[model samples]
Target: MRSILAVFKREVALYFRSPIAYAIPFALTLFFGLLFNDTVTRNNQNAPADVIMTFIPGLFTFLLFLIAPLLTMRLLAEETREGTLEILMTLPMKEWHFIVGKFLAAWLYYTVLLALTLVYAGILWRIGVPDAGIAFGAYFGAWLYGGAVLAMTLIWSAVTEDQIVAAFLGAATILVLWLADIAAAWFANLSNTGEQNSVVAEVIRELGLRAHYTFTMAQGIIRAEDILYFIFMMIAGLFITTRIVEVRRWRS
Candidate 1:
């Protein structure tokens, strides 16, 4: 526990000390600010809920791909590249401890970034009534979504010593997940909606990152399946990361 905290503290410091760490959130703020302004400004007739509900979920999904790779690209890759991973492995600590600590640190940083987005919701509330449930749901969904993304990227980082390679792979993997719905769409278009096609389509849509949040969570409904998907993906990623790190230690 103490070692985990130590690593967590070190990682938090490393993130804040670096100027580049702030760049993605800064960009996110700018993009979301613009999006919110445009949404509210253009929305004269509808309730503020309409604008917010429409914007937040899609934006969160879009931002996930961009932010996850940037934050996690260097987590383990940098350590390996600089040969510090070997030094760290020699310490009297378990691999999961180090992995969990670093994952928590990155997760906390993403939470901070997501927190900044609440200002947009606050602004909407002041202007007009927004659905509190939907707003809060969107935020909760984003937090979990970010965790899943970070976990996957950390896996990529664990296997690769080059930060650029790790970042590219992470981003690519995220892009594929983000577009998973498209694959479903294509298959549906090619095949008639029969029992077989329906089953295939259902499976494909369920595998995509967008449908779970867009259909349910974004609409203010929290389904257990959606929540579990994120949790399962996150744990799966972390588990894979731990194994990879363990293998590397053995080889060293």
Candidate 2:
């Protein structure tokens, strides 16, 4: 636990010291700020809560498609690229400690990024009443969803030594997940009117990111399965990352 905390602190310090950290958050805040402004301007007649519930959660979900890769691409890839992993492996800690520490660090940073966006929520609150439960659920869902995305990106990072390659592959993997909903629809179209078509469609949609958010968390309908899926993804990513580190340690 101490070793993991040390790694977490080190990572947090590194993020603050780097330009990429500031740049990413600034870009996100700016983009979302503009989005919120546009939403307010366009829907002047709609209730604030309605607009927020309808759009912000979906927008945050889309934002995760980009955020996950950017935040995690360097977690392990940079360590390998710079020859630091070898030196780090010489330390007494186990593989899971390092992997969890780093993953948690990145997840915390993402939470901070999400926190910065709360200004929009504040604005909505001040100007008009918003549903507390819905807003809270949306943010909670976004964080969990982003965690899963980040975990997968971390896996991609572990697979490559180059940060750019890691980022590219991570982004590509996320894009595939994002498009899974479209693929599901396309497959359903190919199938004729039968039980098989619906089954196939249902299966594919279940795998995609949107359906999960749209039907459950974003709607303030938090189910055990929906929450568990993201938790499972995070655990799987960290576990696989530990394995990768073990392999690399052995090879080196």
Candidate 3:
């Protein structure tokens, strides 16, 4: 526990000192600020009941596909590239503790990114009545989604010393998971029966991260299965990353 906190503090300090960390929040705020302005301008007459709903989907896509990769690309990749992994492994801490510490640091950073968008929700509340339940669910869902993505990206970061390769693999994995439902729908359509419940389609849809998030949390319906799916992803991702780091530790 002490070792984990030590690593966590170290990573958090590093994040603050890194230019990319500052740049991500700055860019996200600027882009979303423009989007909020445009939304208000277009819906001048009637304030949208839930302005959050209008852009939550887009936010999910942007964060998952673009931001997540950049955030995690250098976590372990840069360490390995600079041969710091050897020094880290020489420490007395367990491999899982190191992985968990790093994961928590990245998760906290992602949470801050999510929190920054809450200003939009507060503004919507002042202008119009937004559904608090829906907003809460969306943000909670996004938090879990981001954690899962970060965990997966961390695995890729452990696999390669090249940050670009890590980022590419992470983004590619997310893209495939995001588009799984669409591919499933296409498969159902090609079957020529217009059946949405084909076995293959159902299986594919179940495999999609978007399906789990969109149907449940995004709709203000919290389901155990959906929550479990994300938890499973996080656990499995971290488990794999631990194993990879263990192997590297042995080699060093």
TM-score leader: 1
Across residues 79-153, which tens digit of lDDT does each residue of candidate 2 receive?
999999989989999899998888888989988988888888888888778778777778888889888888888
Per-candidate RMSD vs. true structure? 1.7, 1.8, 2.1
Residue-level lDDT of model 3, residues 5-74, one tens digit each, is 9989999999989898889889888888888878877885666556455365447544677778887888
Candidate 2, residue 121: how far the Cα is off, in Å? 0.9
Q: Decide which is better by TM-score, 1 or 3.
A: 1
Model 3 misplacement above 4 A: 51-54, 192-197
Worst 10 residues of 2 by lDDT: 46-55
**Ranking of candidates on lDDT, top first:** 1, 3, 2
lDDT tens digits by residue: candidate 1, 1-252:
999999999999999999877887798899889887877777756645655654765587677777788889889999999999989988999999999899999999989888888887777777778777877777788788888889988999999988888989999999888888998888787745777886797788888888877777777778999999999989999999999999999998
The residue ranges of model 1 lying beyond 4 angstroms of the native Cα positions read: 192-194
State in Å the error of residue 94, model 2. Answer: 1.1
Best of the two (1, 3) by lDDT = 1
Query: Against the true structure, candidate 1 has what lDDT?
Result: 0.85
Q: Give the Å shift of residue 113 in candidate 2.
A: 0.8
